[model samples]
Target: MPAPSFMGIYPADSVQEVHSSLPLDPLGPGAADLLAGDVEFRLHYLLQEAKKFMVHGKRTTLMPEDIEHAMEALNIEPVIVPPRPLPQAPFLAVPVPSGTSGAQQQLYTVVDDEIDFATYLKEPLPPALANSAGVKWKAHWLAVEGVQPAIPENPAPSSRAGPSRLPAPTTGAASLRPSAKQHLTTELQLYFSRLTAALIPTLAQLPNLPGNSTPSAPQYSFPDAERHRLAALASVRSDAAVAGILAYLVRWVAESINKTLMGATGTIGCLVDVVEAILDNDVLFVEPYLHQFLGPLLSILLTVPLGPHPPPSGMTPTTIELRTRAADVLAKLVTLYANGYPGLVPRLLSTFKKALTSSPFPSPLGSDYPPAGRYEGAVLGIGACGAHAVREAIWGTNGDGLRSINDLIGLLYPGEGRRNKAPLVRATMRALQQLTTPKPEGATVPPPDSAEVAEVFGPHFVRAFEKRPWQAQELMRLRKGSNGDAAAVQADAAGEEDEEMEEVQA
Candidate 1:
């Protein structure tokens, strides 16, 4: 069937336009037999056309006779037009069987109702994406060069023969050639590092760009680095190469989280997709390499939900597995520290305590640490993940993780580290605060504002915080007749003693 050109026509006016725009042979070949002259046939055609008008371009209002005659002319013996084009029919997208391969491979299928923009960005990285680095980078370069400020070459000299009066070649093509050729390899390395640093954090956040909320690929106007990366990604034959790229991407996501860079949050979804793709494709999941990616992945998974947005949509079985695997890895990491990585638990908790209590700093001003703009979500995510690990270590399987959590909280929040400029610290502390607040007997104290982080740790967080030293300090401060009472008494006595001594000296 011919694809309909009905889009862009509004329902209110399309009916009128449909009548005027009817095909030349509305009654088709059959109209010629019924009409005596061309004039009669044309009138009949117009009349038939008027009868076969559309509402909203999708729903046809053809009478029974019009349909019968039209079908006969077209040699469609049995015309089967539905009463209405039921919206539920999945015509726009076709699902591919799991075993499909080669050029027939389908990239994705949205089995659910509507795919959200963030979810599109978050969907499993296609196996095809595993090695598209070169293409991505080249496309980026092409787009950049397309917009490259056209260097006005010295208008082909006024006099061709004599020594040209052109100005000395200071820059542009003339000056760029030697360094360009020589630094080709080195420049790429440096550029990739810089690009990764600047771009990866923002990649996660880029999907959420305001106003342009629609989801589509060719994510942005392609850049040189993107084109190059994509092309490189496509060139690799072995799954190892793909895994390596994904592993690096995971590292980038983790580092971006650590550095508290902008857009780091969006990267979590992207990394999730990549990991999902690896699993879906049955590509060798390199344990050690993926291990590095796990921390950031878990951090992001734990963090982004604390923000206003929900996690990306379209949870594939592969994605669920990846997330489950990440959780498992996190449990193991915590266990490793619980068992022997002696200082890990304390360090993790220390980081969380510091992030929670620290004063808020805007992203740009705090760019050296994790910035607020992009890094906030990822930082929160990481902090939340770390908090979960701390809680799990302390309370889950054994009681050993408690002291470590206490030491971490004490050290990080200790006189001043708590006030560090990291946003993640602040966000996590916010989580910890909610976790520690007392419930009214049966009333739930309510989960922290950062719900995703809370979810990662479950109910154990409140239980664990109840025993921490910070809780004791806060309780003591709040208690009417605790040590706080003794401190007040001591101050009053000291003040009286000083006053009496001063009067005696006088």
Candidate 2:
């Protein structure tokens, strides 16, 4: 649908008349209409902005000063008319000397009012006002930009005791003596250097080892790195005034994920660990960086193989666990921040859903739709979003060519990374298990019959959870899904009168 037309108060004839009064001559037929529309838009914007000033000032009606303020804001020079203005001067129409022999066009000018300068000067001298205080100057620090001087210009000790104060570098940091990056304090530069050195130890920082071919991969076991790494992670978990470093750290996370994801498992794990550490820090406010964090988290969780090439024999559980860790961070961000940031959950759901449904990579083992790791990560990410998301995406009625997870998991044909695929299956089961409605503290959740478990979660889920009967029974419990499916399943389970308690109790 087209946008509705906003009828403007400006008219074409008035614009044409104003144009005709100028030396530029009358505007063409169509030009005046266009100019009128433009004028209306500009006038509307100015007045609308002017209304803000009125509202801010807590006034009932807009004042003339507001319009002037709006003009200043828009960088337009305003016509400053005095409050007690003279009456509109009569227009003096003079015939313009157009070279053509046709009719001479008229140019209009405002008749200027005469003033008595001698009388105004005589009137101002009537009373002599007391001389205003002569200008004098004094200065104290309002806010210092960089390293403060040792002089008295600095605020005193009691004044410097506020929470905004930056911490001084330790003796170790003083020896390193790293210079501050633009606008960053010496303290933060030292902290970031130590932290990166500990957590993401690049090969260049170490001595050139004789046998290593992979030069750039991060060595997590670098000399003295682990001790410093633990200290760095602990510091991040409790550091104050780190908000200034947040943007740089987010950029670092993104860049490191892109560079290290295909090369080394340890490096990627370190990145996720740092993310979790930052999230764990109650001192640093992360709300501003939530959106930025999503890109790196999604990259970690959804990117397949997690290496340049597939592992020769079996997928490393360590590499796969990185996605799990990333999912945990993803969940922490969504579960905690979703309420404050509207659309965050839906956007996350859309991303995971897209990845979950994408076409499979052709593998020798068998194409199990999308890559197994990505599928598992997507499931975990959605599950992290809480019950509503898990309920809809996994168990809700199919739409947009969607199928339930019960149906989807069954389609996981014998594929590459099949060993690691067990985790994928387990991830699915874990997500569904989280949806069980809470029972009273003393009460127990009634388990559906084993025969009904196959009916509710499909044959594949029963097989997946067959050995662990309680898990399948957990899925069979009343789900927190919004639709009637969960209730229907609950009712069907409730109606089974013939089952022995001993049969399902096992």
Candidate 3:
């Protein structure tokens, strides 16, 4: 079929149809063709002018307002109809069919209005009517002094309140002024650029090692002069404003890591350092921003394929180390805000359980066995949350937790031992040990005995081993020897402490 044409040209057939419709006062010669062509040209001109209005409004599409504005600009009067009730149809009840079901047997009401045939047969349209309130131009400001005021033209408030606490207002007359946020945003952008530049260099190789690693003395020193300057500026700022700035920075860093494959390690490292500096600065406030920080921090911790474009072979050591640092930041956040935010621990644990179990690659021996850096981060994050969280995660509602733990064990130490994800397995073990370890204050419940552990895990133990035949012995050792070994290790540590004390006295 040929494509339809609508380039403003009226067809001859349409002109003939229009001429035929009007018979009482028929057009002579080529009058119908001339009228149709004129009408089409006028419509096309109106549309073109409307598009110009749209362009002035910084829009690509023409709207009803643009058409109205165009008509006014062109000095064209629009036909306005007076407010009148629309013609109503007479209601009639129709009988239901006998064969219909009981539910469908009810009478149906139908509107059957009588048509005015004469109105359709009219030779020409009635004279263009003008209503009592005829179209007239009214002027209003779309924006005033760089701010769209809450006037009739712009009634809705520009700033919306988010779920988090509202940011504290700045001092002076600026608080009452409009566009104050624009100024703050400009200032924050400047600060963020400076901070990003300063921090990016420190990211590749931080003066202080991340995680548990610590040098006897400072391996390297932070550029205190620069850091102190930034911290001082941040300290004097309002808590809410500083929080907003940090939140934006966090989002930027996360986007850079997820969207860009190159420089992911440096980006992640820079993020970790920024967070550390914020936490370490006693002068700077963080409470108001804690809620905002949770999501970006969690995203950084658990984003699958932390770097989409890894080394040609696999993940580089830098990528792995970057992920480890990210996980540590997650743990720190949990510790800092777990008490204030009751839901933090549960959510973190849930993320861990999901990451550990949900994998696209089924076989551990396959090239894709390691999963993503985020999955490993989840494991480390869980361990950092504390033992109670680990217990709840592994022993979810109604023994679901026990099943999840068994699944991880099977995946990590399959019987065949084709490939062992050492880092993942070690993280899981650390979480388990943390879960089972006794607390000094007895705040948490003591670890369950061997009998309980066996009973809870026994049902799936055989099936898990069956999938990986080589890991049966390792599973057995985990089940039988974990408690005894933990006890012995504690005893040995105590013995060494006693010898140290004796040497000190001598």
| Alpha-carbon local distance difference test for all models | 0.40, 0.64, 0.55
Compare candidates 2 and 3 on TM-score and give the better one: 2
* Predicted model with the maximum TM-score: 2
Worst 10 residues of 1 by lDDT: 166-175
Candidate 3, superposed: residue stretches over 4 Å from native: 1-181, 185-190, 202-251, 257-263, 312-320, 359-375, 395-420, 436-506
lDDT of 2 at 17: 86
lDDT of prediction 3: 0.55
* Predicted structure 2: lDDT: 0.64
Q: Clashing pairs in model 3? A: 394-401, 396-401, 415-468, 415-469, 415-470, 415-471, 416-470
Which candidate order results from sorting by TM-score in descending order? 2, 3, 1
Give the residue spans of candidate 2 off by over 4 A: 1-180, 202-223, 312-317, 363-370, 397-407, 415-421, 437-452, 479-506
Could you tell me every candidate's TM-score relative to the true structure? 0.24, 0.53, 0.41
Candidate 1, after superposition: displacement of residue 396 in Å? 18
lDDT of 1 by residue, 183-247 (tens): 23554444334434433223333443332234554455554434543443333323454442343
lDDT of 2 at 168: 19
Output the lDDT of residue 373, model 1: 24
lDDT of 3 by residue, 1-506 (tens): 43223344776568778667766566556555555665796688789879987998899777777777666544455776323343465667666666546443556576665778887657553333423245445688877889876777555664344223212212223322232334346666555555555444333233333321234645444455345534543543324445545544544444444433333354455556667667655655565456555666666666655543434443233555665676677677777778976656876677777776675454333553544455557767777788677656653443355466556655545565533444554455555555343334534333334454456564334343343333333334444565677788899999999999999999
Worst 10 residues of 3 by lDDT: 168-177
Query: Please, what's the RMSD in Å of model 1?
Result: 30.9
